[model samples]
Structures are given as C-alpha cells and as structure tokens.
Target: MDRFVLTDAQWAKMEPHCLGKPTDPGRSGANNRLFLEAVLWIVRTGSPWRDLPATFGNWSTAFRRFRDWREADVFKRIFDALTEEPDMEYAMVDATIVKVHRHGQGAKGGLRARPLAVPKAA
Candidate 1:
C-alpha cells in the first residue's frame, strides 16, 4: 500500500516475466520485498548501496542481489520489457562516436568479475 514501494500492477508486470529463483526463505514471511525496495532506493537517490538507509535490508545483501540479477540477465530482460516498443524501421543514436583512449584497456581487469552490458547482437 506504500506509494514508495512497488504497487501491485508493477509487481504483476514483473512477475510474469521473471523466472529466476526467488529469494530464499529466511524468517517466516520474509518476502524480500525490501530487496526490491533497496533497488528502488538506489535509483531514486542514486546513493551508494553501502549508504542505503538501515530501514532497508543490509546493504551488502541488496547489492549482492543486484549483482546477481545482473549476472542472471534478469535486469536486461526487465529493461527491454519496460522500454517502449522498439521502432522496427527507425533507430536513434544521439552520441558522437569516438575512438577509445589508450587507457581504456586498463579497465579490463575490473570487468572480469562482472558481466558487462554488451549488446547481444553486436
């Protein structure tokens, strides 16, 4: 019933498409709704997860879940589903293309532990 959290309609939109394993049951009725709220908090405030308010679940738990969702491809599916239907015949690119700096490759090591958001078809 809280407007700050996802409403039933939003949950329904997500429920049908998300096939990943649900969060494990801990204390009875621990539905991990806070997990979702934590993610929403991150977007709403754009704060580091460690700075997430204690009213939400542990920051590490929320972040681990966020990273897990990234690894599982769940976040991409949600993004693709929530986006307005693509223009089949028309595409838009707003950015100027530029060659990568020589230091760009230095960032490769940090990426080894996380899945990058690379386009599948590219």
Candidate 2:
C-alpha cells in the first residue's frame, strides 16, 4: 500500500482512541492504520464513500465504521488527544462577518423573473 504519511508517533497517540482493538470485546479491526489512512484519503480528497478504492477494503464497511465512530465520539477523543493548546496569536474573522466589495457584488436587484413587456401595435 502507498505510504499514508501517518508517522509511528502519530499512530501511537491515536491508537488507544480507536475502536475494534484486539483487547476490546468484539472483533478486532483488520488493520487500524490502514483503516485510518483510508479515512484520511476520503477526508483529504473530499470524495464520496462509494468512490473509496478497493485497497481500503469495502467502501460501505468503511463508511459504516466511520459513522459508528462518529456517534461514539471516538474522533473527538482523538482530536483532543493529538491537539495542543490553540494558537491565539493570529486573529481570524468569520466569513459571514466580512462585507463583499462593490465590484464583487451581484446584479443590483436580487434574481427574480421580470414580466416581459408586451409590444403595442403601432
């Protein structure tokens, strides 16, 4: 399989947070690192679940696993475990709060169907 960029240190940090571990009650995941890489591929590429490559295993299974993890707060724990204190040095503006420049504005009136004027017979 192609290298997924997840280093050993990173995987170490994330390992405990994942489900289907051998120590856990039910079936252990086939390969957690591979599954994570598959998930990362989907997230990075913003592709639909159905488009997941065969190398990742069944797309439906991966998606179902993803959904289960999401509901279980597994991802949230992983983020909390991996992230350090947020950097406040840079100020960020909300996109909704920004005003559009005049040149960037759309047509003066909002889009709507205007009644067609009937030509009068001369």
Task: Give per-residue CA lDDT, model 1, range 1-122, as digits (tens).
Answer: 25557776666566544534355353212434556677888999889888998887678866776787778787677767766566566454444645566777576655457678888895
lDDT for 89 in candidate 1 is: 60
lDDT of each: 0.66, 0.83
Give the alpha carbon lDDT tens digit for every residue of 1-122 in model 2: 85776999989999988888755553236577888898899999999999999998899888888888889899899999888555666567777779888767887766789888989889
- The alpha-carbon RMSD values of the candidates against the true structure, listed in the order shown, are 18.1, 9.6
Native-vs-model 1 lDDT?
Answer: 0.66
Return the top candidate by TM-score: 2
Tally clashes: model 1: 0
Q: Give the Å error, residue 96, model 2.
A: 21
